[model samples]
Target: MNILVTGGNGQLGSELKHIAFQYPQLNCMFTDVEELDITNQDDIISYVEEHNVGLIINCAAYTAVDKAESDIERARIINATAVKNLIKACELSSAKLIHISTDYVFNGEAFCPLKESDQVIPLGVYGLTKLEGEQYVVSSNEEGIIIRTSWLYSSFGNNFVKTMMRLGVERESLGVIFDQVGTPTYAADLAGAIMSIINSNEKLDKKGKVYHYSNEGVASWYDFALAIFELSGIKCIVNPIEASEYPTPAKRPYYSVLNKKKIKNDFNISIPYWRDSLRSCLYEIEKSN
Candidate 1:
């Protein structure tokens, strides 16, 4: 099967490229924005047609949470409008589109884990726009799978894990928000899960559906930092603070743990816990250095 991947330079996209070789039957085409602009319907249509793409894994997104407040239009263009174009392209090619979404869709009010069917009440522009993208996929008649993940990190690109690791080496003490709680999804794990679904072809019908996935277990930003320090053997003091103590342009959800039961049952894949994935990622980072 021929698979097309967007945002090929991003964390998830880069990791997908690394593992694509493992699946010999899968023909993968990885493209960044420079090669194929997702915002342009014509570009997407041409690429899909030329490649005879059977599946589209959309990893492109406007991920600046704080900056999104000042630049809502740019965010909408990338997050919502671009996705709409992708959906249209998928419709034309009769390809299955797996779009990556985020946990920020929720307002962070719920104390328990978020299920796929839960009501959405995004608190910021970034979250709202991402949710809009998800809605567009669901409304389209094309075959699609919307996966909502949280606190994603990888060996590539900018993410919380890398940020903490950098700060641990430079600073004597780092302050992290202890109030916010969620699972830290390793991009490799998510990529693996997507590949599993594509290979199985059981859970998703031609019609579109939504699902939630993340690494097992939960942690605050503070706890996550502590784990990084412990795993990397970085001698830095991690100071735990409340969300209000560290203000940002966007309001983050205090709790956004996604329930993986549906995806687990449907795909029949095992997920590593957050700490275990962290260890694996840190180990990879160490080897690279």
Candidate 2:
């Protein structure tokens, strides 16, 4: 099978690139925006035709939450319009699409873990646009799987883990939000889950479906930071504070822990706890540096 992954340079995309080698049956083509502009329908069509792509793993997205407030047009273009284009391309090529979505789609009002069928009430432009992308994929009436994830981090790119690591070394103290509760997903684990879905191929029959995935267990930004520092052995004081204490342009969901029962049962996979994955990621970062 020929698999084409967009946003190849992103955290999850990069992890997919590294692990793609393990799946010898899959011929994976990794393409960032430079290689394949998802916003351009022509580019996608040409690439799909040329490569005989069987599956499209769309990881490309406009992910700047705060900046999206003022940059709605740009965010919508990439998050919504670009996703429509990819769906169209998949439709034309008869290829399966596995699109990554976010937990921000919820308003963070629910005290319990959010399920796949939960109502979405996005609090900001970024979440709204991402939810729009998810709607586009589902409405396309094409073979697709939409995976909603939260608090994703990895050894690649600029994520919370990397930021915390850098601050731990450079600063004496750091303040992180304690009120916001969610799971910290390791990108490698997400990538592994995606690969597992592809390998199983059973879920493909249930296309146009949505599933929630993340590392098992929940933690606040403050707790996640503490874990990172502990795993990395960085001596820095992490101050836990409320969300209102650290204001931003975008209003984040206070609680967005996604339930993994559906994906776990459907794929028959065990998810690692957030702290364990954090430890593994920190070790990888340490070895790289």
Candidate 3:
């Protein structure tokens, strides 16, 4: 089967590229906007038809939360309208779509881990557009999976872990917000789960599915930074700070921890602990350097 992965150079897409070789049966083509613009429905149709893509893993998104506030049109075009174009193309090609979403779709007021069935109340433009994308994904009759993940980082791209590692060395001290709570997801793990779902014997197109995925533990941004420093042996004092202390244009969910029981049970996917995955990513990063 032909598998088309959009956002080819993104964190998740990069990880997917790293692991694609293991699944030799599926012919996977990774593409970024320069390669294939999902905003143009005709382009998506042409690419899918030419590639004979039976599945699409859409990782393309406008993830700049703070910047999205100022660039609403750009964000909306990428995160919402572009998704509609993909859905239309997927329908024409009879391709199942595996769309990636974020935990920001909910307001940070929840007392517990978020479930797939939980209410969605986006706090800012980025989250709102992502939610709009999810709406388009699920509202379709085509078979697909919508994965909402949080705190994603990987060795292949710039992320919280890499940022902490960089700043930890350049500066002696760093203040990370401790108020926000969530789990960190290694892109490799999420990519593995995606591969498993598509490679499984059962037909995923038989039913529509949405699942929450992250590392198997909880952490605040402070804790995450601390782990990065510890794993990398970076001698930096990571001070705890409140979200209000370092305010941004967009408000983040104070509590966006996701519940992974559904995905684990459904796909039999094994999720490593946050620290374990962090260490693994750090090891790869350090080795590469």
Task: Estimate every model's Cα lDDT from 0 to 1.
Answer: 0.92, 0.92, 0.91
Candidate 1 per-residue lDDT, tens place, 54-142, comes to 89999999999999999999999999999999988888899889999999999999989999999999999999999999999898888
Give each model a TM-score. Answer: 0.98, 0.98, 0.98
CA shift of 41, model 3, Å: 0.9
Tens digits of per-residue lDDT, candidate 2, 105-133, equal 99999999999998999999999999999
Clashing pairs in 3: none
TM-score of 3: 0.98
Q: Lowest summed lDDT over 10 consecutive residues: which window, candidate 1? A: 201-210
User: Which segments of model 3 are wrong by more than 4 Å?
Assistant: 205-208
Model 3 lDDT per residue over 1-289, tens place:
9999999999999999999999999899999989898888899999998888899999999989999999999999999999888888889989889999999998989989999999999999999999999999888888788999999999987898888888998998999999999999999999999999887755664444678999999999999999989888999998999999999999999999999998887778889999999999999898889
